[model samples]
Target: MKREEFEKIVEETIESLPEEIKQKLDNVVFIVQDYPDSDELKKTKASKYNLLGLYTGIPLSKRGTSYGMYPATPDRIFIFKANIERICRNEKELKTKIREVVLHEIGHYLGMSEEEVRKALGE
Candidate 1:
């Protein structure tokens, strides 16, 4: 899929989140890359094909009183377009996967573990 179209799907997926969840998101940036970098690919321990998205940065539940006092950076969620597209055959499937990946990352930001994220997203 084209980058613009993929990004639009991502935005739609984000907007589709429950309002309570959406409201809790702060200092987070969502971006898309063609594929996972070598370091990330190693960290995930999955062959590149199986890696879809990643949430990098401190989770909200881990923050303290002085969390934002200085040069701390916002969290980042990366969606791998090539990997995602490889598993999706059509636009509908693409959108669904995008939603799942995005929600999964948001779950992490909200302090959910991998299992919890999958459970919460019911995927």
Candidate 2:
């Protein structure tokens, strides 16, 4: 798919989220990338195909009392366009996978464990 179409699908996925989750996402910035950078791959220990999205920041549950005292930046959730496309055979599957990735990353942002995230997504 074109970059524009990929970004649109991502935006649509975020917009489709529930109001409660949207409110909680106020401090996050979603980043779209063609593929995972070396740093991301190393941190995750995941190869290109396994890494779909990643949440990087101090999760909400682990924030200290001085969480925002300094010039702390907002958390980032990276969505990998290429990896997602590689696993999907069509736009329909891509869109569905995008939603899954979004939800999974948001669960991480909310300090959920992998098991918790999968359970929440009914996976």
TM-score of each: 0.92, 0.92
Ten-residue stretch with the least lDDT total in model 1: 39-48
Against the correct fold, how does model 2 do in TM-score?
0.92
Tens-digit lDDT string for candidate 1 (60-109):
99989998898788898999999999999988898889888988888898
Looking at model 2, residue 103 earns an lDDT score of 86
lDDT of 2 by residue, 1-123 (tens): 888888888899889888987887747888999888888887797887779999999898898888778878899999998889899998899999998998899999999999999999999
Model 1 misplaced stretches (Cα beyond 4 Å): none
Clashes per candidate (backbone, < 3 Å): 0, 0
Tell how far residue 54 is off in model 2, in angstroms. Answer: 0.9
The number of clashing residue pairs in model 1 is 0
